[model samples]
Target: MKTIKGNFIFDKEENKEKIDEFKKFIEKNKDRKGPLMPILQEGQNVFGYLPEEILKLISSKLNIPLAEIYGVATFYSQFTFIPKGKTDIHICLGTACYVKGGADILEEFEKRLNIKKGETTEDRKFSISETRCLGDCGKAPVVEINGKQLAHFTKEDVKKVLEKYK
Candidate 1:
């Protein structure tokens, strides 16, 4: 099996709290297996993504194995093992947008925000990514700041937009 690469140190006390919370969550849905997803969802909400420590906690509480928890988390894309930023900046790299300077727009955001794709800024306010498409091709070269759409942008427009975020 390929290894999962991450470095999330766990505090035993915090893990215990999260474990207790997860137990309560599961008990609330004792009659239904459907609650497993929600149980894991709450876990992710608390710990950012399913870290080893969290998976172990869940396994211990649910009497499952760590491998199964990790497998389930990896099978789903929405389960992130790392912390996400407060604001997510998505730059569309669709064919039309890319041809019309989408790459440059992404670079501008990176330079201005000082963060590479899939990484949050040092202040934890901004996270940036080059996405396949945002479906705003009519306004080619589009970007979204914290899911607020901005279309038909140039370098100057990017600067103006970022000013508000900063």
Candidate 2:
């Protein structure tokens, strides 16, 4: 296994296979009218997150500048540079949730996990993110862990919730 950019770990053989897969995808899509976005999206899908090497490969293959690719990737919130942890934690910061102490719940998560929003723990056990809404405003201050919603969440519940995952 090899680690790329000190964050992504992969088996050398597996990485080669993914690179080959991405290369084929690029070949099929490179000549499309607007190929960059699709290629970047597919690259992220292939690698879990877009690392520098993959971006550079896309640039080289498409004859596009690396900066242009980075610009496009950064402009969209849908794309992330860091890989998500095995467990994803999303705290809703919608109007209702934020008013109901959702921000405080998020702070508690950061403190407990020792990682800021949009970051994964060093061990990659958990990643924390914020969502505009969870569509259950009636149960304000919601926290979704691994796609399971915990509605009406509070800071005090953080420990108990985390313990369940542990």
Candidate 3:
């Protein structure tokens, strides 16, 4: 099986290095109080996204139930099960941004990228997601690409911004 972003599921052979890294992370941190969160975060960092195999590994090493691990991971919006594209786009939907045509900007991205929010393109070049706020209300309609913010973004700017990544 593969994830929506085309990452193979349970292909441990292909992910041996990342799995080893995650194992080291787990060994180094497993004894700490409240280690699950950090373990999961590091797992995501190492694997790009947490797959079932990693989750199961965590459960086995920590002796935590798989269901419990899933519960915690799912509760956090920061954890994503699917691989994010190389260029991740986040559009703010905060009140200020929405009022400034943020929705239109998001629509423009969807139209141009041919993928809805929370989905990565088939080629894995881009992924679109939305946030409630980007804390740049003054700029309104903020678009964040790989951690860099594009303030006062307009629908017309999407093409140019995407060109930079391409």
Candidate 4:
């Protein structure tokens, strides 16, 4: 990987290394019964997310249809096609959080981050997403960033909260 003018670009050698790793994973699981799911899971583990390029490689290596592989990938919520940002912002949208104005908080984050839920910012510093619950209803309208929860935050206080992160 090479960063050119503040952008991280994967060069040809890096792509080859990544594909080689994927091939090793395929070789390990190609003969197992019901290997596609495991292969995909391991691929996700190795690559963080399954892009079309990697999926196509897997399909070709396993002799499976790309459409079928995509169907499986889409069916599972755990599988994400997009890469996660360095900072993960999980805004709880559960009944408790929403009742306490979680929606407004979510909107505030979207406005500040300039990206909708499930999107990473261009700088890759932040990724925004909504969750059903963070299991912290006592602190309704909770926003968890990078596994740490900031509880009882209001929309008016969002800027202050984001300041600590930046």
State which candidate has the highest lDDT: 2
Can you write out model 4's per-residue Cα lDDT over 79-153, one digit (the tens) per residue?
A: 877777888888999999999999999899899989899887777787889999999899898989889998997
**Number of the top TM-score candidate:** 2
Top-down lDDT ranking: 2, 3, 4, 1
TM-score: model 1 vs. ground truth? 0.70
Better lDDT candidate (2, 4): 2
**For candidate 3, what is the lDDT?**
0.89
TM-score of every candidate relative to the true structure: 0.70, 0.92, 0.88, 0.86
Error of 1 at 38 (Å): 3.4
Span of 10 residues, lowest total lDDT, candidate 4: 3-12
Model 1 stretches with alpha carbons more than 4 Å out: 1-22, 34-36, 45-52
lDDT of 3 at 42: 93
Give the lowest summed-lDDT range of ten residues in model 2.
Answer: 3-12
Consecutive 10-residue window with the lowest summed lDDT within model 3: 1-10
Candidate 2 segments exceeding 4 Å error: 1-12
Q: What is the Cα-based lDDT of residue 25 in candidate 1? A: 76
Question: Model 4: clashing residue pairs?
Answer: none
Give the per-residue lDDT digits (tens) of candidate 2, residues 26-140: 9999998999999989988888788787888899999999999999999998888888888899999999999999999999999999889999876778899999999999999
